[model samples]
Target: MLDANLKSQLKAYLERVTQPIEIVASLDDGAKSQELLGLLRDIQGLSSLITLRDDGTDARKPSFSLNRPGADISLRFAGIPLGHEFTSLVLALLQVGGHPSKESPDTLAQIAALQGNFVFETYFSLSCQNCPDVVQALNLMAVLNPNVKHVAIDGALFQEEVDARQVMAVPSVYLNGEPFGQGRMGVEEILAKVDASASTRQAEKLNAQAPFDVLVIGGGPAGAAAAIYAARKGIRTGVAAERFGGQVLDTLAIENFISVKETEGPKLASALEEHVKQYDVDIMNLQRAEQLIPGRDGALHEVRFAGGASLKAKALIIATGARWREMNVPGEQKYRNHGVAYCPHCDGPLFKGKRVAVIGGGNSGVEAAIDLAGIVSHVTLLEFDSKLRADAVLQRKLGSLPNVTVITEALTTEVTGDGRKVNGLSYKDRQSGDTRHIELEGIFVQIGLLPNSDWLKGAIELSPRGEVMVDARGETDLPGIFAAGDVTTTPYKQIIIAMGEGAKASLAAFDHLIRTSAPE
Candidate 1:
């Protein structure tokens, strides 16, 4: 039996629902034994019925079946539908129900006319918080046309599946059981891929042929700057990106960027985009570059986007930035923005007078905890390793802070909260083997960073930690190709550093052009 208040809330949520909803529960030994059956029955009573199954035989099995009654919607919960998971489930339901009204009928009809079923499976690590937008976009497409099915699998939980599928990074999407694309992509771009995949299978396809003077691979600060500069230099530049702003868009504020004392990430991106449009920059938003090969003369590069569009460029510049690494623990993704945050500068003010937890013992972690202690009511610093890896001065300063509690040998295992937001975290002491749960309103995760150069493969040399290698002038080992911004193996990854690298890379590209094409 479920509580009256919980049932009432669920009923209220289902009242406006206009589509089908389903929940798939895992019955593993370690799974929580809550009253989920009764809740499923209640959901069935409120909305159209859909198939649901127990993962008793195999936890990895995809058990939900869809029977379209003109418009069909479905929601699956692999584990206990509580905390952040419940919110995701509810939102997924609402999205499926409202998707038809959101898109035009002709577009929906065009999608439905496709003969073969297209299944898009997107693999995402819980730590990669930027992946939700991609998932939502695909899920909306799935909702509109029953021919399209979208499945989101947790990368860490399904490591064997990920290995078999050769999924090396987060936010990777597979179409029709084949590796379709990777990284964060938008709705229009995904639809284009779906259409291309369908057309290629039906008829003999020819290679793409498009020409441009310059091709910028990323749409971040450096990429945008390079495109604007090159366009102003009278070169026909084309900028292709999965999404504009790269990882910088995840930041809440740009405090250190020049000229702007404090600007939000979205605002800065908008301004950069406006400035780029002032020139002749051909912007291809929501497009991901799938491959890049040097041209015959070595001065030109052939770049192919995910949707099979090709562009030839005389110069190429890579400005892809880095993404924040995650602390792989349960509930971390579920509570993101609600209480779990990666940037202290972004969500610190919201925790005023509230207890907060800071994960990691590195310099960034210690500094963030110290800075947040002033704003929050209390700060708990949890470090998995034996000792703090921060500098001596920072360790001494943090040790002296009365409001900060440093717990060495502590490893966070789970984040616990109500359906809407985070409330606390559970951890275990490595040495003592004792588990403890701390009630808090916020958790800050600082586990270093991951560069966005995995897709480059061996085409360019990379540092020990996977950052692209660049010389003093931002020239990569590959001739006629340049690397810039945080993706490069630069000492600092600040906005000022990225901007300087952008300018250096542009100048280096110009010099390379001059040397190769002299009027000798």
Candidate 2:
């Protein structure tokens, strides 16, 4: 099933196998089963340490398990894992063959120390870019902890199972047959949920760290740039982020980044992290900044975290970034993941052949409508403005799609749901003040982003819209404190602009540090 070039790459990767591994396939006399078998055979031929077996009896035919002989690991895939999941399959092979994981030592320890028996089943679609992270995380956990078992199921292939479970979203995870979560989650996020004391322990550890010369509060493009620039100055630099990559992780396509012709969000985010790691920057992931306490009376600046930990630094650069804006109407939050979604690229496949609505007329909205038109049966795009704000090229592409209908001067009012899932939504005609509702199986919100500056409301000078007010030097109203990226009043919310602002903020903070008196 793999091309010759792919086989060559797989063979090179299989060279890292340090232990005997088996691909146990549970197949039936079907085309899909044959395809899966062929893929497994190709993988098995890549290395001598790997073997294939088809004499398995799994309830789900065409399923397979990756196991190390005599090991208690339980990792299985209920369908042929291709598309974005192909990476998950490759990682599973390498990890099951005794390759060490790249996760933090503390995270690995936490997984290994878990005591309870946990069985996880994640429903995913082939086209979903966010599903691989969840699938690979659970697979790694299963390999690390014998008590943990994970089975990644393709929702598209197993439609009956998806419908029975009411899985209307990608990366819908279940623990012990109960809904656990439905979204893009990494290993740290998953561990924080499973291990209740993890946050407390992490907070305690963070509280004991020494003060940094420059501390970055986010891990998006801006934060990564600030961390790298500060670290390169031969000073102690640290980055505390809720989730490394921030809103960029949720972004799909990024074509405007300079130098790079085209790239995906996750790939660019990974590159940013890797580049930051090349320096002496200390990255603290999964740490949310709750409150910012500016330095006063020669005291160091302290940033409190939601987990009850606080970090102190001489100067702080806030790049907390922004999150997807919600319609904030009735039943919107109630039916989230059930019928309401913000990411068209991630959740579009789940609503294949179903009617959906795209909110907004900007570039994101137009792009989402264009992308979803091919997957969904029909798309109704609603814009609050009189005219679409997207580029002419995008508007032309959206207009050419027969399955999409664009409606201007439309204001979303309420999301209508059938108690369990969304059935439709109500909107108001801005021009005529007439109320209308459209029947749709899903609603993708692409309005815009809301700055994550709510916590800084009373701490700093904020604009009317809650964005941090900063000068050209990226310096905020408070001395020795700066803000960058979408969280600030920076004009455009672009990745390149964010990085440049971050670098400027870092330089400004460094200059402030050397020019002013040291902390007492």
> How big is the positional error of residue 89 in model 2, measured in Å on the Cα after superposition?
0.7
TM-scores, all candidates, are: 0.54, 0.98
* Residue 349 accuracy (lDDT) in model 1: 48
Whole-model lDDT, model 1: 0.69
**Which prediction has the highest lDDT against the true structure?**
2
Backbone clash total, candidate 1: 0
lDDT, candidate 2, 331-372, per-residue tens = 999999999998888888888899999999999999999999
Q: Write the per-residue lDDT of candidate 1 for residues 254-373, one digit (tens) a residue.
A: 677877788767567757888988887777666566676766545467766565656666778888788888878889787665577776754464456779999999988998898888
